[model samples]
Target: MVLCAGASQPPQSSQTLLAGVGDSSRASLSSGNEGGRYELTPERRALLNTIRYAEGTWKDGEDKGYQIMYGGGQFQDLSRHPERVIVKRYTSAAAGAYQFLPKTWKGVAQELRLSSFEPRHQDQAALHLAERRGALDEIDRQGLTKDAMAKLAPEWASFPTKAGHSAYGQPVKSHQELASFYSSNLRQLRNQLGA
Candidate 1:
């Protein structure tokens, strides 16, 4: 299980998942341009935030999780993917808010034209991955659906499929739990947007 910074024993599953499932970049530090053509609508924002929540990268809605490395280590550099392999119970190159593996981050960064591991770039990379998995349309049109979650399962081991299991055989959050969080998060985002 992934530990938070300064924690001795592993936190409960509800607190963090194994940093082994899924796996970004260094372009723009500005979040505004990070979205690029993909609009960061409230629905999309909530969806990305929900993914962060599942990946154990969320903390008080801030960017603290953006620097979190595998095994709860924090990387000081944000200009590019850390590409650092942290070995605890598992070996992983995953870092950033989405916990992207080295290869996965490389691929996504190339695909999305991302330049840095900044918070917004990380967010964009995750969204691009979701879109590649054919889940973005469903997420934009209907919030989080079972099929959407299933599509994202391979991209993120923390997301549950219809069977409520991690696609990568790692630990996962329940669909119901995710849906509940999504609904609440969506509402919060919509409110912020005055939508």
Candidate 2:
């Protein structure tokens, strides 16, 4: 199985799915398959707010504040408050020890940088996703059957695709088609990342 460095294990509760919506500060959770959905409850909202505040504190370089907000064993207790899954995801993404100042912050010596660079980070994510898709396509073109492909990269079953659908489902006409898909999705995601 191909393992991503920081991919969170899929959550068990319905509330865990809400992590993908909205900005880091405010996220609305939804339920049901498609049409039927509902907003998160007040309790869930409170928990989400705590998580967001903790994230903001960490991102703003307030290490003490972040620790105070989350250090009381709260970070590891996310299962009790499933709404904090987004916070968990963010924290997990920042797990490594590399540190530098954020682009916006200057004149602060010895500041640690969080991984939120604007266009560059967005572009890198887009390129990485595109390359993965290209590799998958190459596998297919080289006569690897669906079963073989699955065996090769079992984790592909969980790889996030545009609108949560596989590229094969969308069907590619050529390499140009794949390039087009990458460009379009990259543009959309870059916009979202900026906002």
Candidate 3:
């Protein structure tokens, strides 16, 4: 998580602190800003939420995680992905709920044409990564199966491989814990759809 040389960051004074953004209901998926492309199915939403939970960014189940920087800091602007690197306990350019590294976000954003680091785009980026790793179909059909999680482990350090260790040697959530979280999250997302 070393900050590469010449990486860009906003001036400290210019970074506006956001107190919080409310829960999952706060951002409407039907906003039409980037319709169809970023639309999330319930399974996709649950998978992303579980990843957020594992990443320690599922802050109060709110949109707050969408604004979160690495090391538990928040950035205000949603107009673009914050490529700012932070060097608290760990040096990283990772931001948003899925904890995307700057390079990773840039590639995903470019491929998906995501204009902002808003919650929906973040969700879509996660999905795109999963899709690229060939785990999306399994998640859609089987929820968070071990095979799916294993395929995604390399893409997301918080996800465990089949042997139950992070692909990146970082800490990982247990399969049981992630499975429980995904199940509950999927049920909640489905209920929201019905409502």
Candidate 4:
């Protein structure tokens, strides 16, 4: 149900699923988001944007935008327009730009008190996922590793991989392409952080 910002979506109708948005997001990427957990440095935000870009978007399994989120409880992409009503019967649905399943979203969304699965809430949820995977510490050190990527693979579908996957994950690209994408983005973020 995600729509690229400014794009008009199907008008809201009788279908019901997504939780209504409120000013409930506690923390966000930008500085001084009222009640936000952490203020991301420009470098960190850039890195996250790169990761989301690589991941692409999903709306009931369709690409829509760079920043996307899903709500598993309703099997809807939470990044959808607030007024956009959808009711898909997927056993599981991934939410946010990070593709978090319902169980995962519940925890993350609760902690953040997310009013909507907007990009900011999605970023916070991804940060929490990264922290759980030990990537946050490595990212802070400006050292992203294949090992770290592997450890986090079960979470992030697009983490860099070795020995070209042939044709595995969604939005398939060449191993070389993936490597270049990851390395260039990581380098840029590190430089920005002066790390």
Which portions of model 4 show Cα errors greater than 4 Å?
Answer: 1-35, 58-92, 160-179, 186-195
lDDT of 4: 0.45
Q: Residue by residue across 1-97, what tens digits does model 2's lDDT show?
A: 1112222222122232232233431322222111112123222222222222212222221222222221122232211111221233223222100
Clashing pairs in 2: 100-113
TM-score of each: 0.82, 0.21, 0.81, 0.55
TM-score of 3: 0.81
For every model shown, the clashing-pair count is: 9, 1, 0, 9
In Å, residue 56's CA in model 2 sits off its true spot by: 20
* Candidate 2, superposed: residue stretches over 4 Å from native: 1-3, 6-10, 24-120, 135-195
lDDT of 4 by residue, 1-195 (tens): 111111112222211101111122212222343345645654345345444444544222222332343322223445442322234422224444555555676677688777776666766677777777777677656544555555455565555444433123433333444334445544444453356
Global lDDT of each candidate = 0.70, 0.25, 0.70, 0.45
lDDT of 3 at 165: 91
> By the lDDT metric, which is better: model 2 or model 3?
3
The TM-score-based order of candidates, best leading, equals: 1, 3, 4, 2
**Tens-digit lDDT track for model 3 on 1-97?**
2111111122111011111112443243334224636456667766776777777777656777788887777899988878887887557888888
How do the residues 1-195 of candidate 1 rate in per-residue lDDT, one tens digit apiece?
Answer: 122222122222422221211121112211334457576666777687677778877654456779988777888899998888778766777898888887888887788888888877787788888898999999989989989999998888888778888776767887877787777776655454456
Compare the candidates by TM-score and give the number of the best one: 1
Residue 121 Cα positional deviation in candidate 4, in Å, after optimal superposition: 0.9
Q: Which scores greater on TM-score, model 2 or model 4?
A: 4
